[model samples]
Target: MPIYIYWGEDDYAIERAVVTLRDRILDPLWTSFNYTSFPPEQSDAAIAALNQVMTPAFGAGGRLVWLMNTTLCQNCPENVLAELGRTLQVIPENSFLLLTSRNKPDERLKSTKLFKQLATEFREFPLIPPWKTELLVQAVNQAAQTVGVRLTPQSAAVLAEAVGNDTRLLYNEIEKLRLYAIEQNRPIEVDTITRLVRNTNQNSLQLAAAIRVGDTGKALTILADLINAAEPELRIVATLVGQFRTWLWVKLMVESGERNPGAIAQAAEVANPKRIYFLQQEVQSISLRQLISCLPLLLELEVSLKQGRAELSILQTKVIELCQVCRRN
Candidate 1:
């Protein structure tokens, strides 16, 4: 596809895909003339990217013009979309326009709609949520290849288990694993992942699990470790919200007489249906009233964090309070 569009929250994967395309299309020796990148934050650069794409390659190989890290997903002015739509028509087969953003493309935007018309050339790489182990494993494997790290199936499984659904921090762990493996002159293994990769993700999960079970002491300790690791309180709050939101959905579905975990997971947007079984068990101990109560607490924590009103200690205190409420009598 001459016109390529890639958008997703997986920033590292998005970048790697762009790099692969660049290597495949442009000549390195003539990079200055063959490739150009623009940030579409302003009108001029966005327009410039469009205008440049129609220009022919300098000497050899195809030319590439890129609109990188664009906010068009958030808001695309009418003029910009109109201009982009016009530019797409004139762009030569020899030149490629790469439109990418970390934000999911706004389906409602005119520009996004226009871009969608050329769907044959488009690629969307949305973030794979943590529960989708298979997708995470696939992405992790691809990343390992790019970063020159070797991962055995067992090692990959370990990494996938460590951060199955969320990949925001997976790249960081992969990079660290690569460095440590090179230093040790060995391949990445389950033990290597255990010893080298930070267990902050696991701890966060433990904190959420503890909160679900209403183990205040365990939850508070995990919170302390996460803070000591310099993990942001906002991030911690987001994680809790996500976990509880899933539990709440599962709980609601069960109360409504939904017996199928797959159906419940589909409704909840949980990528893995099999996980719904465990979630059902977790929420079984807590009443619907209790499950419903968790939402307001998390929302309050989020608002306080966003407003910069609460520090770590205050947030931890709130989490402890939440644990007490979640505990079954």
Candidate 2:
């Protein structure tokens, strides 16, 4: 149980997990001697890490060999795979091998299958998509608990809305709240969270909501707020695209008489089927045609942003056009 595979888009979460694992495996005094990290930029890092992990700890602690941002599971060379197979079979009990990646390991790959057979732990830390409100709220609560801060349910929801899927920000905010709660000697509430957390009121998801309702003025205002807050233009467009795409799929499924939430959730690639109910309600007013139309416009907006067009004005124009599309009968 020495091999670990951690992969996903949530880099912050993965790093945090790595820190925890490192702390558990290596003594603080002997860390420098026993801990070895192979960054992805290093040539032959995977092989190097394998070789390093096979070596015993220098002193009083177990050894930890980390292959950070590795792609071995996705595309391991024949030599590397053979080495990995040999290493895993005889890897020392006191030595740990950790492989981390941003991409999901292709399960079809032989390397992935080999890892699955011998991996002590395999965990994915996927970012909660902005549109998945429930998961975000759950993430907020879990982070708060980990940071030793107690949050009212309402406060958790508010914080989730504020941070969206930014795990780093969420953890920082929770730590801040924990410190404030200690000083104030009170439980964290919605009001406290609202006042303390920056950008609590505006986010890309709010922009998507405004566009969903065809509120041109509201969408523009949110767009301005997001821009003023220095949210990336491309990120804003990505959120919109994801939101609209989800709505389109849900709408298409519902209109075609598909009532099973699980089926619809699968089609939309949503994690929780229960959220499909809320999504169904959101898309009830808009036609599938309108949802379908928004994608091309969003694509154009993304293209314009990538093409080095003025961000605010370009975003403003696209938001207005999107609102207009949703408004059409």
Candidate 3:
């Protein structure tokens, strides 16, 4: 019951715990350690290894056992999970057991006898993203500082947008930015951030980018893929409308004495700060008339789709036609 669990998709939180355990508790004191990563598909050997690792010996300083990326409760065979629970009951206090997972365990398990006892004896922390601007900015700053790279306010916003709430991807992208900065011997810039990080929202951003750039061919390709994936036209239209609004805000903000993309993004409340620069540039080419006119068309199409005035085939044709009209305007 001494197994502490730390769960999140946030890589930095998981990494910090891993490093702390390794450095302060395990490595410094010279405890023998075993780290096992159990993906959803590979539970058998991982569970068996955990059983073997936690079996204590009199002379051993203690074992440090780490189970990573496990989804045992959700996907494992019932017999296997039951065996795992039974195994958890016997883990030696002298041995430190750690579980790192992207998903939380079931609520039933959380209230069950074994988990209740484990909770009493062990610490549990969830490192979900804060989903607020301030915390996201702090995360970006902390990650950049780790590598001695300094971000201009604009650069930080770009990095934030490109990484977008995926802490693991943010760290990886920051590391890549660090490498790029070192290789080029330059301060980190927005373009460098854009070049390195591929955010989870990249496709949506790409669609926006293509539309902004008047790349009808690219826009059509992106539209076709979304249509094939069965994404609702109304939803797609709504997203684009929102993106374009953000772009317009950035454009307006920049022209009105707010030259920094980050500042504009913060003021506009755009979720992806990193996109502000591209958006600003993109918005410059779009006339106010086009922005005003296209939105109504998207809205009309949305209503039409909702009313079943057209099937997906017709809806897709309308989308392409909208793209052409927007680009031409």
Candidate 4:
């Protein structure tokens, strides 16, 4: 429990866990001195936090050094790794080092190997697949409870389906539901969720699904809706990129004779391994090279958008080009 490594895309869960650590370790009144949060945005942030972890706590109570989004999981410089290894030896019992990241620790990286030795202290909250209604429902139900609001399983299911599996967005939606429930002085109902939740309106998955099937017309329509909804172009691009990457992984795994759906899904970072069977059947018809062609086009699309050159016309063209590969029967 002294060295906790929490890695996941679920910022909501990660933040909650971090807060729990803070409450359990740091004195409430001396929080300013005992608790420290180091996000990845600052240069040399992880190195600085690692140094602090070895320093003994000042005054009374324990010290918490939260190293959020630690890049050490990547190919960290040998000097930093050496210093971290040394610091770990002297980290006082009253001091804690909490490492977190959005992506899982890449198994290929040597840095991950060091962390692997401490596997018992590591916690991973992977991406829950959008198709896993039960998991989503459980997430929603637990979230509602956290906010002191009661939510029906049906209502929870509705929210999960509409919003997909992004816990950050789910937390925001939960706040809104709680506010609405407070105003009404009642538990959340499916009708209440249907009226207040705008998840279907905000989600861009339909666009990606349409593009996957090469339904250009539907894709274009969905894109228009997204644009009108003021969704950032980069967000839409990210969603499509993730979908294409998943398809490519599934295709490659099947070609490599990986029959275990759980293994493939885990490698692909899909939370719901049961859904991998469907992903397998879907990608079986899609050629590997055909899927590979979409990556460069998508890269170009992202670059053009970032350069302010990819307009609706350009987006339409590139989207169609990317989807064309899936059309191969």
Candidate 5:
């Protein structure tokens, strides 16, 4: 049989799909499961590994062969593609081959004889971002429910706020929350939600807080920590920009006489009410026109860094400089 493929846009659904596949395929059919994952750059080695896995166990019932975490389709070299196409053509029926990726296969490969044959013989499931908030909530709830933990509406809403659209991080937080609940023997109440679900790495939050407070020294300190953690400079920039935007919005909401921080934070999905203070300050410090103008400059900086017009470290420096300037104005 040809290889079955499953892919996802982000880590959570991708991981769930892998877990589901493993549960469904293993244990029932065979004694031994042979699984391997390949990096994108190791095309030749990946092809070799696949061959080894698909080579029958000889007189045994069969084996499950898996290639996980590959980016072959996204960045495969021309010569490697030709070799892969040949290798894929002859996978035997006794072995089950599965390939999971975060990337879609190349269009050229999709049209090739090998991919066509594989597509005809095996199933392909692509994991997409949840189209609705209910879907996203259900996924988190299901994961929690499996662990005998339940989320209150407010807690679930808080979790959603912290996660935004990053289900991978959401799932990770859920796992942590589940473990914490089991250990502590407490229901996930609103106060518990405030402490746990809204939590983030102190550095990321500190950086955001510093930007909100117009504290260049604090922002730079947090930025350094993020960089040392190997966060991409571009990601840091994007995150800072996002926080600034939120601060501007919250400030506007407050100035318009919205006294309830919870209501304002709820609208923006900020789980922590205390965050309102910093957010309100950011709005007060700058005008709406200034915030609007700063966004494009930040975008240009991102483009320059990614396109090699600027070094990553230099880009971070520029980001700090720009934010400091904004604070002054």
Candidate 6:
């Protein structure tokens, strides 16, 4: 397996994987000669990488060529595709070619299809959306294991809730907790995580929750705290939009007399069918009309922020309006 495809929005995880691959494939003594990297700035980087990977290592270790942040899987020129087809067929067993991108490989593209056929591995490190608590918990557990630390299930959940979908933060927190555990000489518990992690109780998801129940004051407070913490305004809007959009879909499905959890989850674009039960309960008090109305206000907020309006004022006003929409009789 000499060819690898790594793609996803979780760039930190992808880079970490690349580092591990580099260590495994390149001999430390000959690393300077065996490793070649192509940043996206270089024109025809894919072709250059493919050409480089064809050459055998200069010394004892295998050759490793990395095409960083490549767009070949998204859109490849016919010439590059032709070159890729040729190189992949004869890439030496001891030489490795790695292509990484933040976007998923477009399955419809010929380049992606070719890579799928020839690449030894296709690994994705997608960022779990903040609303997916189960997946986030699993991520926390996985990172803890990799860091050689033990975490109680309750502590893992707490850590997941604190870090959300930020892979880098999750790993950093786990490492910190590992250190604390070593000092205390005990497995990580909820109290240690609570003491070590910053802003554990506040997040944009909480803002969405506050808005969902029509608690204007609480929503405004959470928004202020997030802003104070230097959270990106656009990112906050993105999370709110995704949360409301999911709620709207679930409510629409349930109102239409759809009972199957799998069907509802599919329609709502939720990864886990088990989450449908919780989503159903969330929107039970709020009307579908309310959910429908929240999206436009949220969009307006996004546009206002992007247009360079006063962030604090615009956010407060739109959040109030969203709360009002949900509060309607």
- The local lDDT score (0 to 100) that residue 68 gets in candidate 3 is 68
**Better lDDT candidate (3, 4):** 4
What's the number of clashes in each of the models? 5, 0, 2, 0, 0, 0
Model 1: runs farther than 4 Å from truth?
Answer: 40-43, 131-138, 141-154, 161-189, 200-203, 227-235, 249-273, 311-314
Which residues of candidate 4, in runs, are more than 4 Å off? Answer: 39-47, 108-110, 131-134, 183-187, 200-202, 208-219, 228-314, 318-329
Better of 3 and 6 by lDDT: 6
lDDT of 5 by residue, 154-248 (tens): 67755664554565667777777877787666568767767876444333445655664467776777676666655556656666566656765
| Model 4 per-residue lDDT tens digits across residues 115-174 | 776533788877665544557778788877887777776888888877767677778888
lDDT digits (tens) for residues 1-329 of candidate 1:
37788887667667878999999998888889989998756557777888898899988889998888877656877787888777777788889988888777778888777778864366767765444456778888977887788999989878876765455567778888877777666677788888876665444557888888888887888788778866667667766777788888998999999999789989888877888888888888888888788889888888887887857867887888889888746
Ten contiguous residues minimizing lDDT sum, candidate 2: 178-187
What are the per-residue Cα lDDT tens digits for candidate 2 across 64-117? 999999999788899998997788979899999999999999999999999999
Clashes by residue pair, model 3: 157-274, 158-274
Which scores higher on lDDT, 2 or 5?
A: 2
Model 2 vs truth, CA RMSD: 3.2
lDDT of 4: 0.78
lDDT of each: 0.78, 0.90, 0.63, 0.78, 0.62, 0.90
Which pairs of residues clash in candidate 2, taking residues 3 or more apart in a chain or in different chains? none
Q: What's each prediction's TM-score?
A: 0.80, 0.85, 0.51, 0.68, 0.60, 0.88
Candidate 2, number of clashes: 0
Please name the candidate that would achieve the greatest TM-score relative to the true structure.
Answer: 6
Q: Candidate 5, which segments miss by more than 4 Å at Cα?
A: 7-16, 28-62, 68-71, 75-94, 102-104, 108-142, 160-173, 183-187, 194-218, 221-230, 241-288, 303-316
lDDT of 3 by residue, 1-329 (tens): 45666665555667777777655434433553333334446547556656755776345355566666665433566576677667776777766666667776665653233554664233344442322344567778987898678898888877775654566677777877777777565578777676766643444446656766667778767777666655446656656666666655666676678877668878877666776765666777776656656667667767787888865666556556656656774
Candidate 1 clashes between residue pairs 3 or more apart in a chain or in different chains: 129-165, 130-164, 130-165, 130-166, 131-165
For the record, the alpha-carbon RMSD of candidate 6 to the native fold, in angstroms, is 2.8
